[model samples]
Target: MNVLIVGAGIGGLSLALMLHKRGIQCELYESARELRPLGVGINLLPHAAVELNELGMMPALAAEGVETSALHYYNMHGQKIWEEPRGLAAGYPVAQLSIHRGVLQMKLAEAVIERLGAGQLHTGMTFDSLEQDEQGITAFFIERGSGQRVSRRADVLIAADGIHSAVRRHFHGEADQLRYSGRMLWRAVTEGEPYLDGRTMFMAGHQDQKFVCYPISEPLRRQGRSLINWIAELRVPQAELPTTDWNREVPAETFARHFDDWRWNWIDIPAIIQGAKAIYEFPLVDKDPLPRWSVGRATLLGDAAHPMYPIGSNGAAQAILDARCLADRLQEAGAGAGHTALELALREYEAERLPATAGIVLRNRLNGPEQVMQIAHERAPGGFEHIHDVIPENELNAISIRYKRIAGFDPAMLARRTTP
Candidate 1:
């Protein structure tokens, strides 16, 4: 089957690799004129790490990212709420990764080009539209800047475009799909002394007001230096969404005042905020889960399929999972299984993953595993003397486990599955 994948982000590139592994011929059409290392850090939970390991890219990933050792959550007063060993430390065979999202994308794109060769992955081609017939599918594209029209035919078209997916918008365009949470985020990386364990990921505060920090660079970690990726989020009173892009730079003075009193004994929050060279502001928004992802020979993947809030560290992880499942079902259908076989495979992939991710989308709105912080704040508006007094041990454990299962990264369940 000649599969056409749209967008060459993490999801699109990973889908290319997975399909190639399944012995299927596929091509990727990316809108960007050039694939540059863009965006900031993101976490790769254990289950998603296993998928990349199977693709034989773990060594490359480990080189660019930190092998996260633990995850810690604290309240506004710097009091510990819940802590857990993560990645291999948590007993999963593979290690969880905290890498720059852009670096990971470039790594995956390079792997795709290496295995599939040059022309298979095309850049400068923007997806304009597509038409599916009883025989196969034909997709139209235009050069990004020059507007040179191009058309290509394939057995299926898979949309792996990011949150603002043109293909998804073309199909599911409605009044107000991108639901704003009234919270805005300012994200940037600061080169500073590593706080806590250099490999630890931590978050302080609740949904509305939160500060998340983690080290991303491995070489810097080895040198006793840290490229600390931090996001300072606040509940903006804007009923309407801000005109923001992931790369739009902003002055820290905009949101730094709200976190002026955030410094504690172990970590100095103000210094980290001021140290960042540039900060990009983005809204904390997500679309309501779609009722379906498959239509004829075309289907959605990654953010295009389900753009959930970045709670519980499941954004890229879920996309990797979706790509793997789609590849598996497509491989099962066989190369010469024909168009009917392709449609069935798409539906099967949807049936399994659509509902699963939809649940996560809704759950993320409720704060997912991070709900513990919300619960803590609701119980004790003032700082807690003891976290147990505010929330029980069983309740804390239950909340963590429930989100793990919902996000499909419960280490106990993952232990049952074979790793690459």
Candidate 2:
């Protein structure tokens, strides 16, 4: 069976690698003429790490990114709300990695090119549309270099093309629209001294206003410094959507002033904001879960299927999980499986992932595990003598565990899935 993958982002690249490992024929088409290391940091939860580890990516990940030690939540006053061990520190089989998003994509692309050969990965191709029949799916692309239309026929077409996926637009059209979260996020990286434990990820404030900071560079950490990746999120008054481009740069003054008083004993928020050479402004937005991610010989994956808030660091992680699940289902469908068998496999993949991710999408809207911070803020707007006084220990622990289970990274659940 031949698989045509749209977009060379994290999900598409990962699916290609997994298919190759299963000895399946797959080709990756990327809209970008070149795959450059771009974007800021992203966290890889244990479940996502487990999938990448299967592909022998842990070493590269560890070398390039920080193995996160703990996750902490704080109130606007910088008072602690909740803290918990994370990654290997949390006793999972693998460590949660915090790495640069662009670097991670390039690493996955490198693996795709090496394992599947350069010929299998095509750049300068933008997905135009697709048509599927009983025999196979034919996808059309505009070759960006020459502005000519090109078509590729394959047994199945997987769209991992992200939130603005053309394939998703083709199917859902105007019905599929991004729901703005009324929050704008300024994302960037800053070089500075390490914070708590040198490998901690922390978030301050509630859903309306929040500051998230985590070191994302292993090289800098080893040198006794840090490369902090942070997001200063603020609630925008406008209910209408703002520009959603990932690379839109803006001055720190746009949102940094809101976090002016975020400095605490451990870290200084203003300095970190000032340190960034470039800050990207993006509104926090997500698409409502689709009723179906697959139709006949075509299916959607990653952001193309379920674009959720990045609240639990599950954006890329969920995408990776989707690739693993889809690849496993396709492999089980058998290599020479006809279009009928392949379509069933796609539906099977959809049945399992669609609802699971949709739950996360809705849950994230409620702030997911970060609900602890929200609860604390709501109960104690001034500050707290003790976090438990505002929010009980049991409540905090329950929120964390529940979110972990929902995100598919519950330690016990993972052990069960991988224990054989």
Best by lDDT: 2
Query: What is the alpha-carbon lDDT for the whole of candidate 1?
Result: 0.91
lDDT of candidate 2 over 202-286, digit per residue (tens): 9999999999999999998999999999998888886568654556999988777788887899999999999999999887889
Model 1 CA lDDT for position 271: 97
The positional error of residue 349 in candidate 2, measured at the CA in angstroms, is 0.4
**Clashing residue pairs, backbone N/CA/C < 3 A, model 1:** none
Report the lDDT of model 2 for residue 4: 94
**Which ten-residue region of model 2 has the weakest summed lDDT?**
238-247
TM-score for each prediction?
A: 0.98, 0.98
* lDDT of each residue in 286-338, candidate 1, tens digit only: 99888888888999999999999888889999999999999999999998888
